[model samples]
Target: MGTETETAPLELDDIQAGALRGRPNPYAGAFLFLRIDDPQDGRTLVRRLAKVVHPADDVTDPLTQTSFSAAFTHAGLCALGVPEESLASFAPEFVQGMAARAGLLGDVGPNAPERWESPLGSDDVHMVLVMLAPNRPQFEQTLELARVTIDDLDGITGVYRQDVFSPADGRNSFGFNDGISQPCVEGAGIPPTNPGERPVKPGEFILGYEDETGSVAPVPQPEVLGRNGSYLVIRKLYTDVAAWRRYLRENASGTDEETLLAAKIVGRWPSGAPLALSPDEDDPELGSDPSRNNVFLYGDDDKGLKCPVGSHARRMNPRDAQVVGEIRLHRLIRRAATFGPALPEGVLEDDGADRGLMFAAINAHLGRQFEFVQAQWIGDGKFVGAPDEVDPLAGAHEDHGTFTVPRRPIRRRLRDLPTFVVNRGGHYFFVPGLSALRWIADLAD
Candidate 1:
């Protein structure tokens, strides 16, 4: 974001990918996840959507999402009549040559859904782009943009709204701020990663880790580097703020309860001082300050004792854990929103409700960062220290039930963890390039 621009054609990293792939302004939005069904399915989707799609392994090229796919814009939708070849490559300099080809030109409209900035990072384009507008005309214009995207895709897998305007104060259910701590891609500042942590290894985050047998863990064999694509985690988290608040009001917070509990659960206070450093008060200003939001970690303080052993902040990203403990570059670049109805004045008088966050996590490894955080730190009682229970905020599990601790006198235990947050639904989806979409569109069922 600083004046730094790549002289060479920069292939989009996770964070940067989010910035380049969307139309400038959208009134509404949605996060879409797609399954190819099989390897052949993956290949078929590639043909039609190739223009906007980028392959993960194309790390060096820096195109949106490193692949090609349809860009839902009014003009783009209008251009459907144009030749696919022309729209395939958006390089203006090459437009002349592309236009010269047959089946490359089409009718572009007054509003074409083009890539402006994306969620994961700037270099990549988002899978879905929705618009929310002020008036009906605007709505109709944006609806056309959405229509273009819908027409191009296979079908809607799942859809959920994310925001925090009252009823949707927090995540719908997964607990904690879903996209609160993602790392910004080198170029496009996104979910904002750990401040001092080194930039993730070039392809290390997206590509699957190699094993003794040279086989990747999750799937995709021949597409080895294609494994370069990040594993996308989408979860519908419903927040029960009333419940979250009720527990706090009733329980005594040992002076550090209210704020500490929040940071412990969110891994950081609203001010951004990681509980690792400032564990006591909610530095509202600090947490609110973008520059200082994610500034500290386990090492800033001399003893690293500022944050407790199992505190969410420490468990989430023990920056010094690499030096003292075994925590690695477990940062996830999240892109999500808070959703649901706004709490009425009456509800506000009591507490917010029917609100939650839609979590869209992008990471190279699920078993590591995403899953590990949920299991070890959030769900596991033995995360980084002795006798600590799961993360009070994000660690609610089905089989394991609620995990609690007595940080003060060490007498607390997880009571039936009143379902403050609920996991409505979610899944893993792959966002291919625009070219990939075209390939699929041309597919015969």
Candidate 2:
């Protein structure tokens, strides 16, 4: 670990609230993608956004108001007249943009950006506007405020927008508990929700700080532009809930067996109880307890007797489990929300409407953290001792995907698992620090 820096008061006023804070309520969330029609006029709109944008210091401010955050795509910065030399200082993957590396993240064939719903990979998308509130009305109120600011600017064009919020019981579209495991950033002063996990270096999630390697991460050119900033990867994933449930039903017998099969595949019960502790059945009590739910490690279950080694949870975060690389190097601060309505009670047929998750992962080093997880961990199961296996929940399976469940008598092998989740589209965004926002808005050229 890096030598600890003096714990000074973080510039909450200079950091965007979303990069450091979790959603206060489960009711409302939305995103807006915009294109820069004119550079100078867009900067004028940005200046307006800066004043109303939410800061990390929300506790003392007006409590009833909604929260908003803003970020830019690489092209957005270029459109705003940020110099080419300055832009070159950013990470290559980000500059190249998410669309260029879609195949590496496993968005190929049917799931490629060409088939994406809207302005995801196109040059048209330049900026992203994020809004969150306690309810729909408040959310819209906040959205309108942003809309009104850029209204008639003749500098920006609305490309696409999507609203996302948490479903009941913290379950995703797949009927399993989501967002249970998240990393804590050291010195961010945010209370650690998962008790057992140690806090990672702030540099892992924010700029101008030492990372787990005990070294400061490289900042983009012009110190103010990169300081306290972090890379944000936003992905729109569509889940085939009915198809997933149907597969389990066909493979396993009875309710009891079906539940177990689902648990094995995800490495957690529907209630979020990890198989590591409550191996046999779902324990809602343990699952709901914040202090206990995320406390277990894979030390005792290296062979995956309790949780399958290649299961979704284990692969995403192999806590204390033996792994090939430095675990801390690839950690991500995940802030995700489910979109689209849930399918009816027992219905296992296609609803046809779009439904999935608006996933956002924040980290300082985009390549080492978010991209590494997607390319090496989520897309491949070989590192965790499962060769040719992919994450059952998120992998873009082109070939016959398989998952092995260890049992006392014999191991159960799930073969030919169809792709359960598909990447509809996504992008690499630069969530600037508040100072950067000011610098951007004030640019002369």
Candidate 3:
């Protein structure tokens, strides 16, 4: 509880907009991965990017609402000629990269790194550029700006590009409203979405500030490069909508029971209504209200009568509930978006379309935050008293997986939970501050 009362101002102008701000709903965007063939050319592209990237403060204005951000993989930094000592200063998990840690993260079976998209886990992929805007036109404008920086560069080659957009209903591919429980960072100029929700220390997400531990977590070497920067964990996940629908149809007795069962697994309705508050049924009004949607806790539902103890939401946040580890320390700022065509309503047959989500988890400490939550909470359900079970929706489920739905008298257990979400590709990135971008751009060869 070090410095719990101390509030330090964040360098909003130095931090990248994508690091702290959430994307607007009903938005359009793209993720572009580039490979650096030459060091000088990479530096040149970075020099141009320094001017294009927006600071966090710029996002507060409605007029300039577009988000254009850049991040580098460990290989990317090495390609940029970052000094050996400076590169070594980064977190070990980041230095090892996501692909190498696949086993620990439950990225096995069909989701293995060897099966990942081409160049995703490979060293050829250096930098990742993300753009988000309210509409297609604005999105195009931002994309054009990025193109200008790299289109003519002979050394930087575009390896992969995936366009992402929000669905009309503002729900994920699974039909559940996501992005509902982001942590409020203190001094980030954003208020808490839920009443009484304490603002997490800025150091928990940004470097050079006092964190919950009352100390500054280790930053990448050299203050200029690490201060105001944060680590970003990106993963491309493919959702099998048809399979999910088929599972529900087969297990549930009726349409109403199907919906209730789905809610019990996810801990929320498709409308984002938490089961802790609306345990009986979906409430569209309460689900849409930001103040109410994420306000409830699990203290009253210890027996999992409302939201199941091992449900996706309960395992993800826990929210004042009794759990193995401190929930607040493992909080993540999720900036996830849906991509590809939406499966038509009530279709049970596999259409063979590539539809999924681009999940970006931002935090200062990758080990304590993203990796910890993924390994301990989502992959293993022991903390919630269900060791054999995993997150029903996002877990790395095999045909043998089971989900427990706590209910009256005897609890219902779902068996043979097929994997709904498959890991397509991903990597760890260092989202440097604006000044750090310039420093990298101006680095000596």
TM-score of every candidate relative to the true structure: 0.59, 0.95, 0.97
What is the Cα-based lDDT of residue 141 in candidate 3? 91
Which predicted model would earn the best lDDT? 3
Error of 1 at 181 (Å): 3.1
Per-residue lDDT tens digits of candidate 2, residues 191-277?
677666798887888877878887877788798998778898999889888888888889988889989999999999999999998
Global Cα lDDT for candidate 1:
0.41
Worst 10 residues of 1 by lDDT: 104-113
Residue range 212-270, candidate 1, lDDT tens digits: 22333342222321333444555556666766665654564553575455554556665
lDDT of 3 by residue, 1-445 (tens): 2233335589999999889987866689999999999999999999999998888987465324788899999999999999999999998999999999998999999999999999888898899999989888999999988988798889999999999998888888889898899899988888788765698888988877888887787878788999889999999999999989999999999999999999998899999999999999999999999878988778899999999999998888988888887788899999998998889999999799899999999988899999999999999988989889889989988756999888878989999998899999999999999999999999888
Better of 1 and 2 by TM-score: 2
Supply candidate 2's per-residue lDDT for 415.
Answer: 92
Total colliding residue pairs, candidate 1: 120
From the highest lDDT down, the ranking of the candidates is 3, 2, 1
lDDT of 2 at 59: 64
Residue 106 error for model 1, in Å? 50
Local distance difference test, candidate 3: 0.90
